[model samples]
Target: MAGQWVEVLGGIMEGSGQILRVSTALNCLLGLLLWVQKIRAGAARHA
Candidate 1:
C-alpha cells in the first residue's frame, strides 16, 4: 500500500495515543497515515 494515504480526523475520540497507535498499525498494514486535528486530547502534552 505504498504511496497510498489514510486520513483520520481527531476530537471524536478521547485518546489520541490510541488513535495514533491504531492508525500507525493501519498504516503499516494499509498505507500512509494522515492524522488531522489530533490535539484534542493532549494539546499541551503534544506541544
Candidate 2:
C-alpha cells in the first residue's frame, strides 16, 4: 500500500511539473509574438 501511494504521488508531481513547463513555454511564445508585433508597428510608423 505504501508503495502504491508513493507511485501515485510521484506521478502527480511529474504531471504538475510538465504542466508548469508547458505554461512557461506558452508565455515565452506569447511574449516573443508581442515583441515582433511591436517592432513591426514601429517600423511602419517610421516608414
Candidate 3:
C-alpha cells in the first residue's frame, strides 16, 4: 500500500512540474511584450 501511494505521489509531482514550467514561460513572454511596448511609447513621445 505504501509503495502504491508513493507512485501516485510521484505522478502528481511530475504533472505539477509540467504546469509550473508552462506558466513561467508564458509569464516571461508577456513581460517581454509589455517592455517592448513601453520602450516604443517612450521613443514616440521624444520624437
Q: Name the top lDDT candidate.
A: 1
TM-score of each: 0.55, 0.34, 0.34
lDDT of model number 2: 0.33
Tell me the tens digit of each residue's lDDT in model 1 across 1-47.
Answer: 66665567766755777777787788787667565565464555543
Poorly placed runs, candidate 3 (over 4 Å): 1-14, 32-47
List runs of model 2 lying over 4 Å from the truth: 1-14, 32-47
Give the TM-score comparing model 3 with the true structure, all chains together: 0.34
Could you tell me the lDDT of residue 27 within candidate 2? 53
Model 3 is weakest, by summed lDDT over 10 consecutive residues, at: 1-10
Candidate 3, residue 18: how far the Cα is off, in Å? 0.4
Candidate 3 Cα deviation (angstroms), residue 27 = 0.3
- Candidate 2 lDDT over 1-47, as tens digits, reads 11121111222323445544554555565432211112122222343
Better of 1 and 3 by lDDT: 1
Q: Model 3 residue 32 lDDT?
A: 24
Model 3 scores a C-alpha lDDT of 0.33
Worst 10 residues of 1 by lDDT: 38-47
